[model samples]
Target chain A: MASSSEPSALPTLLVFRVRELRFLAALRERYRVLDFFTSGSPLAAFLAAAAGGADPPRALVTVGGDSVRVDAALLDAVPSLRFVHSTGAGLDHIDLGECARRGVGVASSGTVYSTDVADHAVGLLVDVLRRVSAADRFVRRGLWPLHGDYPLGSKLGGKRVGIIGLGNIGTLIAKRLAAFGCVICYSSRKPKESVSYWYFPSVHDLASESDVLVVACALTRETRHIVNKDVLAALGKDGVVVNIGRGPNIDEAELVAALKEGRIAGASLDVFDKEPKVPAELFSMDNVVLTHHVAVFTTESRSDLRDVTISNLEAFFAGRPLLNPVLHS
Target chain B: MASSSEPSALPTLLVFRVRELRFLAALRERYRVLDFFTSGSPLAAFLAAAAGGADPPRALVTVGGDSVRVDAALLDAVPSLRFVHSTGAGLDHIDLGECARRGVGVASSGTVYSTDVADHAVGLLVDVLRRVSAADRFVRRGLWPLHGDYPLGSKLGGKRVGIIGLGNIGTLIAKRLAAFGCVICYSSRKPKESVSYWYFPSVHDLASESDVLVVACALTRETRHIVNKDVLAALGKDGVVVNIGRGPNIDEAELVAALKEGRIAGASLDVFDKEPKVPAELFSMDNVVLTHHVAVFTTESRSDLRDVTISNLEAFFAGRPLLNPVLHS
Candidate 1:
C-alpha cells in the first residue's frame, strides 16, 4: 500500500509503537497513518528508507512505556522529526533532554490516566491492608468453613499514609484515601505549597511516620531506587508499601528481602524492575499483592489517551501550543 | 480461675460470644464477668441455672455477631435483664422489638465500626471494578510474560456507584468513593435530607442507573434479598456489586446465577447468605472476591469496641445514658 502518487492534505503521523489497533482508525481519519508495525521492516532499514525518502515523517506518535528508546541516535536518523506525541503518561522511554536539544515539541498523555492510576494505587493499598486477595484464594480453595474465619485485617482509619510523589496521581490518591479517614503526608523533592498535607524532606522520615507508603513518582536518575533498604527498614514491620509508580522507583530486591524477613508488613506492586517478570519469591507471599504493570491501562483511559494523542498532533500541525508539552525548560 | 465468693461492690455482667480473649480481661476489670461459655453447660441449662441463682444477671454484653441467639426465650429466663449491650453493629441477631417491649435498654458498637466497614466496602468496590485480586493471581501464576498484558480493567472514575441503605456505614462508603470521582447515589426506605447525593426509591432503579452497586444495609425481613434477580438484572452486564453489609442483603442464589450467566461484571463479597459456608459455585469464579465476613473485625476496632462496651456498662451501673443506644423509641 506504499504506492501513493497523490500528496494528500493530511499531515503524516509516523506511529512508532501502538498495539491498540482501534485507536489507529480514529488517527487515520485525520493523519496519513504510517504505522511502523504494519511496515514489517527491520528497525535500521525502515529508518534508513524513511530518512532517504523524499517526504520523511515530520511528526511522530508512540504508545505505551515500552522498550522503544527515542534517543539522540534515533533523532539523528529522523532529522525532520520536529514533534512527538508520547501518548503515555511516562516519558522515561523518551529522552527528554535529547528531544529538547533537537528543538522537538514533546507532548504526553497529560493527566488523562491519573484518576485510573490513583484509583488503582488505593485499590492495591486496601488489598494489602485488608488481605482481600489472600482471603479470596482461601475461600476458592474451600478453606472458610474448614478453617473457620480468616485472619483479622488492619483498619485504614487514622493510619498515616505517606505518598512518595505528590504529583497529579499522588495527589488524587491522597484525596481518595483522606475520605477513608487516613492521615495524609507526602515526600517530594520540594513541598507542594497548594496542599496542606504534611511534607517529609526525606523518604526515610516519611516511611518512619507512615503505616502505608505509596510510590507515585516518575522514574528518573535521582528518583530511581528511592525506596531502598533503609527506607523499607524505617517503614517498620507494621508498615505496608504500595507502588503504582515505575518499577525501578523502589529497589525490588530490597523489597523482596524485606517481605521475606517480615521487616515490612506487606506491599502491593503493579510495576516490577523487570516488568512482566515479577520476582518468583512474591508468588507465595500472602502479604504482598502483585499485578502486571497496568495502573494506567484501562478501556476508559484508552479513549482519553487517544484524544490526548490526536489533539496534540492536531495542535502541532495547526501552529498552536501543545496540549501536554513536556521539557518545561 | 473460679474463686470463692467474695462480696465485691461491682455489679455482675453476663458475657456471651467473645472469642477475642484479650477483650475479656478488660471487661473483668469493670464488673464480675460471668462468661456463659465457661459454664460448660448447654445454653438452656446455663440460662436455667443463672435464673435459679439468688443474684440473677441483670446486664449482658456480647461481641462478634455470632450464632448466640439473644431472643425472647433467653430474655424471659433472665427477667431481671434491664440493660442489654450488643457490642456489634448489626442488631438483626437480637429481636429489637421484643427488647423494646421488655423495657431493655440496648446499646451497640455505635459509629466505632462505621469507618472500618466503609473502608472495606470501598476496598471491595475497587477490587471488583479493577480486578486487583485476579490480576495478582495471574502475576503470581507467572502468566504475564507468557500471555502478554493481562486484560484491561474498567476505570473507577466517572463510575455511577449506587449505595443501598444510607446509614452510617453506607454514608461513609459514599463519602470515600465520592472522592475517587465516582457519582454517588443511594436507595433506602426514604430519602435522607442531610446528604445531597441523589436518592433512588427502589433498589432496581438504583441498579438501573449504577455502574457499581454496594450493599451496605442491615439484614431484616424487608431488606433481606433486596438485591434479588430483578435488581441484579437491572445492574446490567458492565455492572459490579460489593457487599460489606449482611450476606442475605443480596440473594446468594440470584447473585450466583447472574455471575454464572455474565449478567453482572463482578462481585466482591465479605458476607454470604450462609456465612462460614459460602456458595461452592462461587469458589471457581475469578470475577468474585470472597472473604469470611471480617469487614468490621480489626485489632483497632476491638480496642474501640472494648472501650465502648466498658463505657456502656459503667454508664448503666452509674445510672447514666447508654453510649450507643439502639432500638430507638
Candidate 2:
C-alpha cells in the first residue's frame, strides 16, 4: 500500500470505460481514474503511455456485462495490478483462476443486484402465470373486443416453485414468492442447513415436483445447460420456467423446442444462450414472456453497485480487508 | 323452504348465461340451473315457462364481468326469487338497493378472489416499476442488439406504496409488498383499529406521500372517480399507478392525459372505464401496461368462486344464512 505521507495525491485507477459519469466523478474524488477508452488517443499509444507512467496503476476497475475480458494477456500488460474490482455481481468475464494464480485480490458488488434480480424474477413469473404481457399485447392490438374475454390465467398461490441455485438471488426470490403463498423448494450444489425449504439434490428432481422452475444459478462449466431437455420434460406440459440467471443456464434450443411442442406450458426468459439474439419462434408464442437481460439493471441497484465498488477500492487502498472478496480457486 | 321429501330432485337455479361450463357443471350437482341464453328458446318464452312451472326458479346465479344487468324489472319478472348469487366479485351490474328493498338476499364470491387480485396488483406494480412489459416488447421487436442496453427501471424496495382501500385484497397486497421491503400506507373510508400500516384520510394525501398508488377499493357511488386529476397530480411525475380495482374508480381521461403529459411515471391498468375498450393513446406508450380486466379471472380463483357460490346457494336453501351475504342499505 502507498504510504500515508503523500495523502494529497490519490492513487491511480485504470478503467476501460464507465457508463455513468456521476460514478466516475465519485471515484475521481479518491483516485486518479485513467480511462483508456475515453482518452482522446490511439489504443496502442494510450497503453504505451500507461505502461511508462511514473506511478503505474495498481488497481483495475471494470463493469460487469461490458464484455471486458480480463485474462492473463491483459494482466501481463498491467504487471503492477494487484487488485480487480467489478462493479457488478457477475464474475463470468473476469478470469478468476488467473487472478488467483497471480495473487490478485478480487472484489465484487456482492448482493447489491440480488434484490433487483429477485424482484425481476418474481415479476417474470407473475407475468407468465397471470399472462400480463400477453394480455397487454391482446389489448394493444384491440383484440379484447374482437375476442370476448381474455383466457383465464393460472394462479401463483399454491404453486410449487423450484428454484435452481438457492443462492443470494434465489433465496430472495423464494422469500417474495412465499408471501404470495407459493410453495418453495430448491436444488443447489449442497443443501443449506437451517433453511426449512425442501431441497432436491438434482435439478431434474426439483423440476418434476415444481409447477414453476426458476433458474437463478451462476453460469459455470458444470452448470452450463443445467436446465436441459430432461429438466424441461420433467417440468411437464403444465409447468412454466423463468430464467433470471445467465442465459446458458438453460439450453435455449431445448427450451424453444419444449415451448413449441407444448412440452412445457410457458416460459418467461430474461436471458438467452446468445443474448440479443433470441429464437424467433418465441416471438409469436403467447405463452412466452421475453425481455432483454435486464434483471439487474435498476436505478437503485446501479447506484448501490457504484457505492459498493467505491467502498471496495477505498478499503483496498486503506490497507483494510475488502468488503466482498472473491475467494481464490 | 321446500321439504327434503324428493331427495333426487335439485333446487331450481335461474341463470342467463354461463361463461365457464366447468363452473356450471359444478353447480349442476347441487341445483338445476335453468339456462335462458342456451335454452334455444326466446328469453320471453323461457321466463313464461319458468313462471308457469310448479317449481319456479327461486335463486338467480350470475357471473361477474359478464355485464349481466339484473334490475328491478328482471327481479319483478321472477317474483319467487329470494336470493341472487354472483359467481364472481363486484356487484356493479346488480342493483343492491333494489334487491334490499325487495327483501332479496345477495351472496357474492367474497374473498375467494382476494389473493389472486392482490397477487395481480403486486404483479402490475412490479411490471410498471421494472418495465417488464416494455422490456418484453423491446426484446420481441428485436431491438436488444440494436440498443445495447435497455433503460434502467426503479426498484420496488424502499418505495412508498399507498393503497386506496385496506380491505381484503388491498390488505393482502400490502402484506406481499411489505415482504419486498416496501413501506405501506393506505386510505380507506374509516381507519380500523389494531392495524399498524400508516393511514391517510384521503387518497389525494396518500398520493402526495406515496411513490406508488394502488387502486384496490370497491366501485361505489362515493368511490367512483376517486382518483381524479388532483390525485394524479399529487402522485407526481415519478409516481406509478396500479389499478386492480374497478376502472371507474379512476378518471380514465385524466389518467390518459397525465400519462401523455408525463404527469405520472407510468400506470398498469387491469380494469378500464369501459369493458373491452381502452384509450388508443395507451397503445403506443411504453410506460403503461394494459390488461383485459382479468385481475380475478385466474383458473384457481374461478374454481374457488364456483365453490363459494355453490356453498352460498346450498346454505340459503338449507334454511341457514348465506355464506357470503353482501349487506345492503
Candidate 3:
C-alpha cells in the first residue's frame, strides 16, 4: 500500500513501453510523465525510476516483453508506485503474487489485442488453406506454364476447424470462419455457454477430429507444451496447425519433427519461445510459415492499447477502481 | 441448332481445351467410356465422335481455356448435340448469342467459381495491406533494414474498401471482408436489395472515397476500362487497388502509368489484359504484387465445379432445364 505521501506533489507516470513514439507523446499530453523506457533496459530503467527524486510516478505502465524477478525487486522499492498496467493482453509479465501481497492494483490491455490477433490468425488460415503464398511464389518465380497449369488449391469451406480457446480472439475467429460455411468446434478450459459449436473436452480430441487446429488460448502453467508431438500425430498427415497463442504452448521441437516427418501437413506460427531468434530450421521448410510475435501489432490495436493503459493510469491516480483490473489471486 | 439426326447416331463427346489434365480425367469419369482427344486437334476429335455409330455422348464439354471457334464449328455439324457445358465461370469463349440463335442451351460453371475468387481477393487484400509478399521477398533476399527497421504493414480495420461488383464472387468477397472489420461499400450496375452496404453511384465516386479500390466486377463493354487513370488518381497516394476481375476492366496501360508515377500506394493483380504477359514494369516495382489468373483454381472449388458440370451434363442428357443456363438477350 502507498504511504500517506504529501498531497501537494503532482503524480508522475512511468511510461515503460509503447508500439510507437506517438503513443508516448499522447500519454505525456494527459499526465505528468516522468521517465519513459522499454523492457530492453529492464534493470537500468527500474533502478533509475526507483531512485528518482521526490515526485516519482505513482504508477508504472509496462509494455513490450515480459519482466521477471529482477523487475519485481525494483517494483517493490518504489513505495510511491501503487499500480501497474500492462499494454498487452497477457498478464504473464508482472509478479502478480508480490503485487497482491503489497496491496498494489494491476490492469491489462485485454480485449484491445483481440481484433489484431484475430486478423493475423485469419490471414494465416487463408494463406495455408488457399496456398496463396506458395502459388504466388511459384508464379512470381516464373514457374507458371505459358498456358496456366498447377495443382488445384484447397478451400476453407466445409473444412473442420478446431479452435483451442474460446476467448475474445477465438470467438471472433469462430464468427469469421462461420461466414465461410466452416464447421467450427472449440476446446477451451471450460466450454463457452450459448454457442452451437461442438465442444471437445481435450486438446488431443480436438486435434484428432479437426482438419485444422488453431491455438488462441493464453499461456499458463497447465498449457505448457499443450500441443506436443502426440497432438501433432493425432492431427494426422492432412491436418494443419496454427499457433497464435504463446510459443511454449506448442512444443517447438515436436512441431519441427512433425512437419519434417509429414505427421502434420503444415503449420503457421506467430509466436516463438525465443522470439526474433526463431529456429533457423523452421525457416528452411516450405510447409511452415513464420512470423515474429507480432500477431497483436496493428495500427488500430496499438492506439487502443495506449488508450487502455492511459485510462488505467488515470483511474489509479484518481483513486477510482481500475478498468480491466488483473486480479493477482 | 444441331441438325436432325437420331440420338443413337450421334458421335462420342469431344473434350477440348482442358487446361488441367487432372480436371479432365475427373470429369471424364461421368462421360461414356470412349476415345478422347484434347485441344490439340478439335477437328480430328469431332470427326471421331461423329463416326461412332453407337454410345454417342450427344453433347460436347469444353474445359480450360476459351473454346476456339474451330471447335464450335466442328461440333455444330453434330445433329444430335443437345447442349454445350463450359466448365468455366466466364462465357466469353462459347458465343452465347450464337448458341441461343442455334437453339442450343449453354450452361457454365457459375457460383462454383466464388470460393476460389473470394479466396484470391482476400489474398490480394492481405498481400497489399500487410505487404506480406514484399516483406517475404525482402526476408528471402536478405534485404532487411532497407529503411533500417521492420517493414511497415497497414491495418485492415477502419479502412474504407470499395468493391466494384456485387455478383457471386463480389458478394463472397464482401462476406470475408466483413470479418476484417472494414467499412464496406460497393458499386454495381444495379443495387442489390439483400445487402445494406453503402453504394456509390459511380466508379469515380467509389475510387475517391475508398482507401482500397477492388475490382471484382465482370468484363463487358460497360465495365471495360472503368478503373482507368482517373479512378486510379482519385485513389490517391495512400490508397491500394486490387483486381480479381478480368484484366480489361482496368486500363492496364493507364494503371502502369499511375503505379509508375506513384498516384496510388500499391496494387495486387491476379489477371492482366494479356495474361501470362504481365508488364515487365510491374515485376520490377516493390509496390505491386502479381499472380497468374488462378483465383478460381482451388481444390475445393475445382471439385465443386466438376460436380456441377457433371450434373449439368446429366440434366442435359435427361432433357431437363440446365441449372446455370447462359443466354443472350
Candidate 4:
C-alpha cells in the first residue's frame, strides 16, 4: 500500500492483529503505520520483512486476552522491537519473561479498565444474590399476576466475599462491595501489605469461609483452574461466584457441574472457557448470568483504553517512562 | 377462632391482610391473635364485632402496601385500638393523622428492610446501567457464539446519580454508589440538614442534572406521580431511572412512552404503577428491567420484619415505647 503523505520521515510504528479504526487513525497521524492485519501477508512473513527493512519498527501494538502471542520467536523475528503495548489489561498472552530477557519494555491497559471491571463484578454479584436478572425474566414472561410473587432474593449486606486476585480490579471490587456492607477477604499470591482485609493462603481456604467468590485474577500457569471442584464445594450450597477475569481462571466444567447439582447457589460469568462458545448447559439455567466477555468493554472504558494506548505508544517513542508499565514476574 | 389455650385472659392482637405463616406462628406464641382474613366476616363487620366484644383488642398488626387501609372508617369501628404495627417499611396505607387524632401509636417495619431495599436499589441500578439482564438474556438465547460481542454496558463510575427520597433506604443507596465514584445528588420535599449530598428542591431540577434517578421515597399524596413526564424528559436520552420505592412514584404511562420513544436510556423497576399488572409494553423491551414488587421481601428481611413487629407489639402491651415508631406530621 502507498500513502499520500511523506512515508519515511515519521518514526516507524508496527501494529499487530488488533484493528480498532479510531485508535488506528490516531496512531497514523503521528507515525508511518505498519498494520500487520492489513498488510495482505502472514504476521510472521510481515514481521520478518519489517525487521530486515532499512527503517525497522522499534515499537509495536498488540492485543492481550490470549488473542496474540508475543513470544521469543516473534521477538526474534523483529530484532529492532524495543517496546510492546497491549490494549488489554491482562498480559497473559504476551511472554513477559521473553520480553524481559531481551530488555524490552511493556505497557498494559493499566487502571483504565479497573473501574469498569469492578463495577461489573459488583453488578454481577448483586444480580446473582438479589436475583435481579431472574426477577426481570419473571416479569417479562408475565408471570407476576399469575404466580402472585416471584421467589424472594437473598439479602446482600452481610455476605462474606472472597476475592481471588486482589490486584487493581480486585481492590476496586473490594472497595465497592465494602460500601454495600459486605465482608471482604482475599487469596492473592501473597497478602498485600496495603490492604487491611483478612487474607487466606489458598483458594480452597478462602472459599471455605466465603459466601461469594469473585474471581478477578490474571490468567497464568498457577492461577488456571484456581476455582475447581474443591473450592466450589467449600463455598457450599448458598455460595455465589462472580468472574470478571479470563475464562480459564476457573474450571468451567466443574463450575457447570457445581451449579447443576445445586452445590453452589449461583454464578455470574462474563468470560467463558471458549470465546463466543458458552456452555450449552448454561443457556438453560437461571441460577447463572452469562455475558459474552464484556466486563470491561463499556463505551466509556473503550474511549479511555484508546487514549491510554495512544499515550503509551507516544510515551515509548519519546523515550519517556511508559504510562502504564507491566511488571514481569 | 376457639383455641386450646386460654383465650379470654390474653391481650387481643388483631391482624390485617398480610399472612406470613412463620410470622403468624411466632406471633401466636405471644398474643391472642385475631386475623381479619380468617375471621369469616367482612373487614368492617369484623372490626364492629371485635370493637363490641367483651375482650377488645388494644393492638393490631397490619401490612403497608396499600393492600389494607387502616383509615378513619376502620379506626372509628375499632375505638379500643391503641397501637398498629405495620409489617411493611412503607406506611402510606395507614392514616397517620387519624391514628394521631385518636392517640393511636404507629410502629412501622422501620430500618429492618432499609438495607435490603437499598441493596436491591443498587442492584437494579447496576443491572440497568450495565445491561446485566440483557446480556444474560443474550447468552441464554444461544446468541453469543452467533452474535459475537453483545452490546456494551455503560459505566457506573462518575455518573451523577440523583436520589428521589434520600430517606433511610435512599441514604444507604447513596452510600453504596458513592464508593463506585458516583456523584450523589438528591430531590426531596425539603433539603436535609444532615445530608452533605447536593440537594435539588424538585424532581425536574434533579433530573436535569442527573444521569441516574433512584426513586426511594414513600408513596404519599404529595409524592405520588412525583416523577412525571417533564421530570423524565429532563432526565434526557441517556438517563437511567431506578424505582425501589413505590410504582406510582413514577407516572407509568409517561414512563412507558418515554422508554418507547427513547427519551430515556433504560429503567430498572421493582415496583410498577399497577404492580402485578405491569405495562405489557415493558415485557418486550430489553432496555427496561421489571420485577414484580419484591424488593424488600428477601428471606433475611422477612425474618427481621417478623422479629421487629413482634417486639413492637410486646413493647406496646408492656406499656413501653414502640420499637419502630412513625412520626405523624
Best by lDDT: 2
Off by over 4 Å in 4: A1-12, A16-19, A32-56, A327-329, B1-9, B37-56, B327-329
Maximum-TM-score candidate: 1
- Candidate 1 lDDT tens digits, A76-131: 98898898888767888888889999898888889998999999999999888988
Question: Can you give the TM-score per candidate against the true fold?
Answer: 0.94, 0.92, 0.87, 0.93
DockQ of 4: 0.80
lDDT of 2 by residue, B76-195 (tens): 777888888876668887888889999888988888999999998999999999999999899888888896556789999999999999999999999899989999999999896857
Worst 10 residues of 4 chain B by lDDT: B1-10
TM-score between candidate 3 chain A and the true chain A: 0.88
For candidate 2, the chain B TM-score comes to 0.92
lDDT of 4 by residue, A91-119 (tens): 88888999999988888888988998899
RMSD of 2: 4.3
Residues forming the 10-long window of minimal summed lDDT in candidate 1 chain A: A1-10
TM-score of chain B of 1: 0.95
- Clashing pairs in model 2, backbone N/Cα/C closer than 3 A: none
**lDDT by residue (tens digit), candidate 1, B112-198:** 888888888888888877889989888888888896556688898789999999998999988998899899999999999999999
Give the proportion of true interface contacts each model preserves, from 0 to 1.
Answer: 0.93, 0.91, 0.41, 0.95
Q: At residue A151, what lDDT does model 3 achieve?
A: 60
What pairs collide in candidate 4?
none
Better of 1 and 3 by TM-score: 1
Q: Report the C-alpha lDDT of model 3 over B42-89, residue by residue, as the tens digit.
A: 565555545454554567677543345423564455645557777866
Please list all clashing residue pairs in model 3, or write none if there are none.
A153-B299, B11-B49
